[model samples]
Target: MNADTRALLSEAFAIIDGIPDDAIRFGAPRSIKGPTLDDGTVCSPEGWLAQHPRFIERGLRLTEDGSAILYRGEGSASVPAALPMARALGLPLDEARRLFGQREEFTANPDNPLTDKQLWEQRVREVLGKAHSPRAEVQELAETGSLDPHFGHDVPL
Candidate 1:
């Protein structure tokens, strides 16, 4: 990923980490359950984007049915169509696609009763570590003689 993409992912991850587990109900860009938060926040990627100070001008909000994000208010789409999650989040299309897949694979299974915030965050770290681990770094050096792109090159072996 490019620096900007990496930064975006890191920002998103941080926002997610800060949110309490009860506030989260993943499976879509917006919560599958509508208006779960006391403030009517959707509590998913769409909610994250909506809550983000950077893209507040986009006026992105969850549909009443809680399916997707759509522009609301002034400059809103004439048809009020749902925005693509990537576009709403201001992420590059490809990176958003990959991130979505990562979210699915790295997050806890919705059906697993043992899942919790600690377990979910642990899983997230494990997936992230695979990309940044010393073994991955050594393997990259062995194959390409250069580091993979992104921050933190001083990983302990």
Candidate 2:
């Protein structure tokens, strides 16, 4: 990833890590095999989250190779729960969604190595650069309490 996108992701990951356990609702692991990566490394999902804690709400599953996949499936509460992280980072919901979408896409692509964080940096930069006006709209919506209609009012964002 470019320095900027990497920096933003770093910030996002920090916020996710800083969130208290009480603030998060952990989901059951999608795989019964536990948190083994494709390389046969065995780790607990919770342990994995301890280092890469952003997946607490995003939901994680073990790949056949035993790597953890951070995914927000359809009907997942992770998306709405994630809005607060965006708000904390001063990012609009659309921008956050795009970033998360990019992460999902990158994780699913088999052509590249799984650990390549910089592989999708250009795409993330493009998404981040294309938006400038939505922040104002999100701020207005937050101020007017209209965010609930879209992002759900229960979320602190």
Best by lDDT: 1
Query: Who wins the TM-score comparison?
Result: 1
Q: TM-score for model 2?
A: 0.29
Clash counts per candidate, in order, are: 0, 8
- Runs of candidate 2 with Cα error greater than 4 angstroms are 1-7, 10-82, 102-120, 128-157
Worst 10 residues of 1 by lDDT: 148-157
Range of the 10 consecutive residues with the lowest summed lDDT in candidate 2:
148-157
Whole-model Cα lDDT per candidate?
0.45, 0.36
What are the per-residue Cα lDDT tens digits for candidate 1 across 2-110?
Answer: 5554444444455455555665654444453332333334355445555454445545554545544565532232332223545655555554444443244444554
Reference-based lDDT, residue 138, model 1: 44
Compute the lDDT of residue 22 as modeled in candidate 1.
Answer: 63
